[model samples]
Target: MKRKEKFENRKTVRKTECRRSRNLGSCPAAEVSKLQKTVNSFAYTLEKAHFLDYVQYASNEKRIFRRAFLTGLLRGFGTAVGVTVLGAVIIYLFQALAKSNLPYIADFISDIIDIIEKTRK
Candidate 1:
């Protein structure tokens, strides 16, 4: 049998067994109590996790947009500063290499530095 069919058959069998065992004909109250307990547990979990606070925050469009804008602005500024520092470090390394005894590498780095200087003019 299909998986879903098997699951449904088992569920039906359990319901019948439960009714027989409890001697409850319709078992409406028992089902309602079970549902209520499940709902209460879910609500308690949500409350404990502060889900309502997050929902309230998300419901405010202006606050969400403002937070997003500030986050993006900080990220962009951080990226710019990081890149500048990294570039400076790389140039310093190149300068050190230019001062070293390796003639070919020194010449190549010097040429690159000259090109960069020319670009600023």
Candidate 2:
């Protein structure tokens, strides 16, 4: 019975020592510090990548906006010029038609004047 009790106590001591050693072996101070630094740097790198992507997206948007603005400006200018030319042409044709009918209008007026004179006499 004495030997069995002694053997049991020795086994308990060995188990405690093994547990402590295992806990110490899992994470040393140097490795724990290195892991913390790695985690921080990983987070920083992701932030940088996101910032760069945002910059690129903004640049592309700016370029597209400028192109749209320029295109709208040119189209507006062209429309203005085309409308002005079309208005001028319509006015010129109306004036030409009036001039061409003037001679007929004058002859009708002269015939009316002659008839009135003959009727008075």
Among these predictions, the greatest lDDT belongs to 1
Give stretches of model 1 more than 4 Å off: 1-41
Error in Å for residue 78 of model 2: 0.4
C-alpha lDDT values of all predictions:
0.88, 0.73
Q: For residues 1-121, write the lDDT of model 1, one tens digit per residue.
A: 9999999998898787766775554566777599679999999999999999999999999999999999999999999999999988998999899989596999999998888789879
Give the deviation of candidate 1 from the true structure as CA RMSD.
Answer: 7.2
lDDT of 2 by residue, 34-110 (tens): 76799999989989789777677688987879989999999999999999999668555555654565777645655
Q: Candidate 2: minimum summed lDDT over ten consecutive residues — where?
A: 90-99
Assess candidate 1 and give its TM-score to the true structure. 0.68
Candidate 1 lDDT trough over 10 residues, lowest sum: 19-28
Question: How does model 2 score by TM-score?
Answer: 0.36
Error of 1 at 49 (Å): 3.1
